[model samples]
Structures are given as C-alpha cells and as structure tokens.
Target: MSKRGSGLFFAILLAFALILSACGNNNGGGNQGGGSEGGKSSGGGDNKTLSLLTGGTGGTYYPLGGSMAQIISDETDYNANAQSSGASAENMQALKNGEADIAFSQTDIAAYALNGELMFKDNKVDNVKAIGTLYPETVQIITTKGSGINSVEDLKGKSVSVGAPGSGVNANAQQILEIHGLSFDDIKAQSLSFDESTDGIQSGSIDAAFITAGTPTAAVESLSAQKEIRVIPIADDKIKQLIEKYPYYAEDTVPKGTYKIPEDVKTVAVKAMLVVRDDMPEDDVYAITKAIFENTDKITHAKGKLIKAETALDGIGDLPLHPGAEKYFSEKGVQK
Candidate 1:
C-alpha cells in the first residue's frame, strides 16, 4: 500500500506542475501579442500608421487625401490611411483632440481656427500646423439660368444655399455678403451640403448657392449637366474689398468653358491645404511632405495637378508651418 500510494501521488503532482507551467507561458505570450497589436494601432511602432482626415466622399478633399495617403504609404516608412471626415473646422478639432495626425483643410478655415474667429470663436485650435497650401478653393456663387440673380446684390430676398453650417464655405458666404452690403438677414439663407445645394437648385427649392471648392467642382458640374447654371461673377470692386478684409482670399476666375458659361466669371478663393499635428516628429513630417510634393504627378484628382512645390505657400496666411514641411520647403528654396 505504501509504494503504490506514493507513486500515484507523485504522478498527480507532476501533472499539476505541467499544467501551471503551460498556463504561465500562455499568459506571457498573450501580453506580448497584445503589446504588438497596440503598437501598430497607435502609430507607436517602426511601421507607424497615421490617420489622415479628409472630407466627405463627394468633395475634392476625400479623393485628393486618398491619393496623398497612398503616396505617403508607398514612398515612406510610415503608413497612412485617409478617413472621410467633416472637413476644415472638424478636421482642426480632430487634430486638437489627438484623433488625427493629418488633415485637409481650407486656408481661410485654418486661419479662423488658429485665431479663434468666425466659426471657431473663443475656441482656438493651437495644435495644428500647416504642411502646405495645395490649391485654390474658388468661391462659386451658382444659380440656374433665368433665376434673375445676376450679382451678389440680386441675391436679396431669394433662397440661397450658404454651405453647410459652421463650414468655411459659410464663412466665405457671410464675408462676401457683408462686403456686398448684405447679410444673411438679407437673403433666405439655407445651410446645405454641396450635393444638397445642387439638388435644391434642381428642384427649384433653392434659388442659388455659395459653393467654395476647386474650379470645375463635381457638384456644380453635375448640376450644370441637367440645367444650364450660371456662375455669377463677383464684381471686381467687391473682390478688392473682400481681399482687403480677408487677406487669405485671392481673386480667381472661373474660365468660361469651365462651366459652359458665356464669359469668364470673377470670384475669390481660399486655398486647400494640408495640416498636421504639431507634435509629429520632424523627420516623419519631413518625409511625409517630401513624399507628397515629389509625387504630385501620381495624384489622379484634377486638383492634384495644381499641387506644386512652387505654390505651396500661396495662401498659408498666419498659420504656422510644421517644422517638417518648413524643412522640406526650405531645402527646395521655397520661400514662406
């Protein structure tokens, strides 16, 4: 009885020890795996992935941002993925909140965010720094033929889409109106997206819209296809006034054939730009900026063609440039 019982007890103890050893090894492996996953997700590893915030799918920013992300991922050590967002104001907030590493924004909107003015009143976003200005976002005031809206003054008493609420477009519209001796109170203001504004015009619900985007905007192009649309020219005198008040604005012309209009339409424009979190490593930001400008030809969007190193600082205004971008631009002899 003693020999048999002793052997059985020894065997049971050995099996329990083996089980404990296996459990310890499994726990150690689980921790290492969790850490690796976290590093990849949080942009903390050698192959860091950055979140690049862009605009809605229908607009220029989303497509251009996607192209830029592809360039960054393909050419640099970092991986970037562009996520569709609410554009400028929201993108600035995302950067300030640490939810994004890069974003596409309008120059005027970036100025407003930095200064805590207009839509960003009393809540300045100080963490965003510019990569560079990309292209001009023309402020197109569109109306259908025979709407009797020939100028900014004629917009009085008519329904006009003033862009989405709290958007850069809205601010532009307000400023343009103010310069024209009008205010939102003078018109039936409607807050609508590009697609919604165009649809409103088609359905006769909106008399006109203030669309701030690159020339030959998709929404305006689509609207023109079904109905003859008119891009009302901002008078030269008013444009002068606009530029005087908002130094970020530049006079732009919508070429006659751009929308099949009878003549070139004068307008003002803000620039589209890239902004990055100020805390990004200088080397990483430098690589990102270099990748973008060096590879602009790879970008398939129409606006992408306009992205050149020479014009990178066209309308940056008072927003601070990321050290990385500044480094790249300085190396290229680009003056800020």
Candidate 2:
C-alpha cells in the first residue's frame, strides 16, 4: 500500500490540477477579449479604436480628415483611421449606423438629419452632434462663356451637373435652382461628382455645374485652366430669401480673381463641420475635441484652409454641440 502508490497518486493529482488551471486561463482570456465593448476604456486604456468618415478624394474632407485622424492616433491612445465617403449625407448615415465614429458634413446636411428634412425626410438621425466647423463650402455655379447659360434662371431647359447624388452640393444645387424658379423637371439634370462635372463641362455635355467646395477647389481650378469659365452670380435677393428660410446659408462671393472669370460671383455658402454621435461619452469627446482645438492652427496651415477654432461653433445650424466639445470651447472662452 506503500510509497510507490502514494507517489503515483500525487503525480496524477498534480497533472490534473495543471490541466484545469490551463483551461481556466484560456477561457478567461477569450471572454475578456470578446466582452470588450465601446471605445478606449473611459478608465484610461489604449484599446479603443475609431474611424473617421470623410468625403471623396477630390474634396477637402478627405485630406483634412486624414490629417485629423493622424492627429487623433498620435495624440491619444486610441487608434483612429479615415475613410472616403460620398460626402455629407452618406457621412451622417455612417455615424448613425455605427460605421464611423466621426465625420465631416456640411452644416445644412447636418441640420437636415436632425430635423428630418430633405434626403433624411423619413429617416431622421437623432444621434449626431457637432464637434466643430472645419471651413466654408462655397456654392460655385460654373459654366463656360460659350455655354450660353449665364444665370441660375438661364439653366432652365439646359443640361446641368447638379452634383453626385447624396452630396451636399446636390442639395445646394436643387435649392439654388428652386429659388430661381427652376426645377429638375425644367432642366436637364446630371448627377455628377466634382471631377465628373468638370469633365462634363469640358466635354460640352454639361451646360453648367454646381460645385460646393472651399475656395480654389481643385476641380474648378482645373476647369479654369482648360477654358474661360464663368462662375455666375446668384442674385442677392434670392440669397436673402435662402438664408431666411434655411438659416444655414450665408452670403459669400467668389472674388473676381478666384477663377479665370472677370467678375466676382455672389453665392450662398455653408460650413463644413466635424460631427460625432451624441451618445459618445463626454470625457472621450472632450479629450478629442480638446486635442483638435489646440492644434487647429497647425491643421489649418497644413490643410491650407480657413479652419479657425474660435469660429468653429459659429454656424452649427440646428445640430447641438457635443457636451464634451462645448466644455472645451467654453473653457477657451468661446461662447456657445
């Protein structure tokens, strides 16, 4: 009954115990990873990841957003990345559907999402909130002198490139035409992207195109270099009515020297804004907003745009500022 039997029994028990411990460790590790939810631990961990939804490569959002995403990844523990999207409307929907954590959108589109108007008429996105404004998007209505189309009203019965479907430019085009007493039914409408629209103009397939972008937009610049393009003026009276009704529209003018055109063109403009989900934790949002605000100058210089942190909250339309962003701006003595 002796020492041999006792030793064998002890060895067997130890082996079984080791196997049970190993299994327990494996199960615990799996659960920990699977149970992980939400962004970086608000408790301060580097496990969180975020995605930024930007506009097409031809527009300002993609580059600016890529820079912002880099800043976020470099300045914080969370990993951030940027993705190109179909501009405002798609970006908003991305945020609502959890496809993106942050996005760049035109102020008017953000307003539409919150109020359930226009494209978002039947499906309102209530989770979006403003982070800040990046820059102004001027509504540029371009055409060559040979096109025989001069003003918004002249667009009637003419082929026009409104903008890519779901883009903020398209909405601006529709509203601009309606203000001029023209509708899609009255004009030959073309839903083309900025690059495509410019091509359309160059090919003479498009009489005029509506391009909403920052000053000196690449698409328009290329068109000007290829031909003498005129950015027709949107009369002041219509601009006034637009701003009165939408409140997001601001009167802007393409300076006389902006393009090859000889004269300045009056236009209605909207701000490009950074947005996030309203349900994002205040501290996380606060940290991100603070990082961006503090680096706004660097971002603007690198991006070559008018991105003033001080004026970020100025024309946010009906979209409420995320509490975290509001706090940072408030501390900096930026009212509202």
Candidate 3:
C-alpha cells in the first residue's frame, strides 16, 4: 500500500476505536464508577466504578461518603465517586434512577422508601435494601441563648429552618412538630442546609432550626463559638411515645461533652444506613459491605465515628438486610 494510504487507514482505525470506547463508557450507567473491588469492568475490561450517593456537603452523610469512597479507592482498584444530593430522600431517588450504585441514608428514610411509606407515599422504592447501620443522628435544635426559646413550645411564632424538604432531617422535624401541634406555619419555615441555617441565624434571617447530626457538627460548633447556642431538650415523655410508634427511632443522648451543654441532652435518634439496589450482584455487594466494615477507621474519622463495625454495626434500619450483606455478617459472626 502507498505510505499516504497507510497513514489514512491508521487514522480511521484510531477514530473508530475512540468511538467504540466512548460508546462503552456511555453504557456503564452508575455502576461504571469503578470503586467496587469485585465490580464488573467496562467493555468486558477488568475495570469497575461505583457511584455512592449521600447528602448535602453541609452534613455528615457527605463526609462519611467521602471517607468510604477514599477507602474503596485505596483498598481496591475501582474508581469510587461520592455524589452529593439532598440527603436521604434525594439519595434514594438517585439510587432508583440508577444514578448511584450505593447510598448513605437515614434508617427512617430508608424504611419509608422501601415500604413506600411517608415521604415516599404514592411511589415505592421496593428495590432498596440495607447493608448496615452506621451511626445515630441526634435531633439538634439550637436557638440563640437569649431568644427566650427555652422549650420546644417556645418555638411558636419564631422563624425556623427545618431543613430542606424530602430530607430525612426535615421529615423527622415535621413529624415531631405535627405531634407537638406545630406546622411550618407556626414558625416561618426555611428549607436550608445546616450551613445555610447557621448563616441564617447569625445574620438574623431566622431564629432556630432543627439540626439532626452526629455532634459536634461544624456548623453548630462554629455558631456556638461566635454566640451562645443553646441546645433544646426534647420533651422526654413526648419523645417516648414517638419512639414507640416509630420503630426506627430510639432514645439517644448527645452527651454533655459533645456540645457545651449543662448535662446529657436527650433526644430522639435514628440510625444512618448504608444501602444498595437489590439487583446488584451478590458478590459485588458483599465486597462493598465487607470493605466498609474492614475499613471502619476511615469512616469513623471522616465526619464522626459513625461506623464502629465491631461495636456499633447494628442493623437498626427498617429495611431488610441485603442478602450479600447478610453473608458478610454471618461469616463474621456478628449478631444482627
């Protein structure tokens, strides 16, 4: 063949190859994120990716997910990407839409999504399943110490940021408020994240907001440092009934030391959960779940020690355990 013809032929081959590679990448969906150890590779290649969906950048879920993704990438060859959404509800939606392969969520939201209950009413996410419980999320309500908001009842007529709609924190706050006869109306509602809410209160845009997190949240800590931030104590007797009705909740205390509190602050708490779609390969799910437990230190140091696999890996979430995850726990002899 002529030299010019040979060069043209090579260029055409390169272009066709590039097109094929792009096509392969486009077909991967969310699972192509390449963070799973045993995750399937692309275009029949031994490369994998796993997308982990968590909450807003202002919360624990995002940091915890960052840690998990770091661990996944460090311990394995898969490229893991941690996605940011509006927390539990939005994460579930991402999972259902195949935008994320795995997700970090609140147990209550996970249950609601799985059972098609409140927050997920009228539509069901039956494919949801839990890997394990990560940590407790204490309902943190802080008001300016001098706002005269000494009690939950005092929130009446005050402006409030109850978290973004469809978020687990928002749902929890809403449920608790309704039981207390307070709606978004009784207090002006500001659907903001922890950071935005902090700024809101500091700038006098709002009075108070419900912050459900593993204390001490950076936002709360910063606010408390600049001004007096009083943690509102939930009525124990009132919360008791709520806990009884909501099987996903428990009585958890954000110890005095967690924040500058007078004593142990009692509140209703829920477990954070790691979850995945039911259709994921059992081997892949097992590897992902096991990797998390094996690298508990990474998660603990991420935002808070939310996943103490040995001492605190409780399946407190309402969703059924993923079969792959069940296998990991069984092999480890950790009682579910």
lDDT per residue, candidate 1, 1-336, as tens digits?
Answer: 699999999999999999999997666343321212112223323666889998866578887888998988887766789998878888999999999999999998998899888878977999989999999999999998889999899999999999777888889999999998999999999998888899999999999999888877877888888999999999989999999988889999999888778888889998999999999888778888888998999998998889999999978867899988898899999987
Which of the two, 1 or 2, has more lDDT? 1
Tens-place lDDT per residue, model 3, 26-60, is: 78475544334443333234446778987767677
User: In model 2, what lDDT does residue 11 have?
Assistant: 96
Candidate numbers, best lDDT first, in rank order: 1, 2, 3
Pairing residues by index, what is the TM-score of model 2? 0.83
Q: What's the C-alpha lDDT at position 249 in model 3?
A: 77
Per-residue lDDT over 1-336 for candidate 2, one digit per residue giving the tens place of the 0 to 100 score: 699999999999999999999997666343232112212232333446888898877667777887888777656545789898888999999889987889989999998888998899998998889998877789989899888877888988988888777679888988888787888899899998888888889998888988888877777888888989889888889999888877888999888887667777889889888999987777778878877766665564334346666888888755799988888788888875
Q: Which candidate has the highest lDDT of all?
A: 1
lDDT, each prediction: 0.87, 0.81, 0.77
